[model samples]
Target: MAHDASGGEIVAAAGTTGGKKAGFFARIVIFIRQVIAELRKVVTPTRKELLKFTAVVLGFVVIMMALVYGLDYLFSWVTTVVFGVPS
Candidate 1:
């Protein structure tokens, strides 16, 4: 019952028995519409907040990488010391 800018008849409620099934174009339109609706509800962060979040995430990633690297090096050294060259 709905129509688009191109005057193409848009199908509605494909889930219903009498309703028409949506085609590929119709599905795309529906998906875009839903995305727009969701975006409208989103509360965007301010520039300062965005920068803070980015810095925090980057710091956490760096800390985790360092921790993993330290653990790996410690384990490798311990293994080498315990089991020397098997000649």
Candidate 2:
């Protein structure tokens, strides 16, 4: 067992592969185990944190939409003034 730079344990696989490649099913099992191990480390946000994040995202999106709409309106007005309102 060794420790990596990030302070995490560097785990070596138990048993030897005898210099032979793992079969397809063996590889799949290894991948699924790794996936499960990673999933176990995931942290879920609390309800308050989730709501705050959602509000922040929605507010940012609304601000961007308003900025785009204002720019579009300004461009349209300028175009109309320059082109004499398309007759």
Candidate 3:
């Protein structure tokens, strides 16, 4: 089975091969059909699950931002010590 870029989970549909280039409108129709098909396969989370996911994401982002800020502060302190305080 063919693998996608992120992982081996995504495999192209069977027998979906490239043929002659489609016309502009034909390509647009094909794109819309593909989008709808993918959307149909999507599984949306429940309200509670969505809230939990959002909280986890926000917490992780806050933690990461704090870490980056801490590191930046540390580097700036070190730089100031090594080069003397700027006027």
Per-residue CA lDDT of candidate 1, range 1-87, in tens? 676554444456546676557678878987777667667779999999999999999999999999999999999899889997568
How would you encode candidate 2's per-residue C-alpha lDDT over 30-78 as one tens digit per residue? 6676666677779999999999999999999999999999999999999
Task: Give the number of the best model, judged by TM-score.
Answer: 3
By lDDT, rank the candidates, best first: 1, 2, 3
**Candidate 3 — worst ten consecutive residues by lDDT sum?**
2-11
Write the residue-wise lDDT of candidate 3 on 1-87 in tens digits. 333443322334547885445567865766676566677779999999999999999999999999999999999999999999878
lDDT of 3 at 35: 67
Clashing pairs in 1: none
Each prediction's RMSD over C-alphas, in Å, is 5.5, 5.9, 7.5
| Residues forming the 10-long window of minimal summed lDDT in candidate 1 | 5-14
Ranking by TM-score: 3, 2, 1
Candidate 3 — what's its lDDT? 0.74
Q: Alpha-carbon error at 79 in model 2, in Å?
A: 2.7
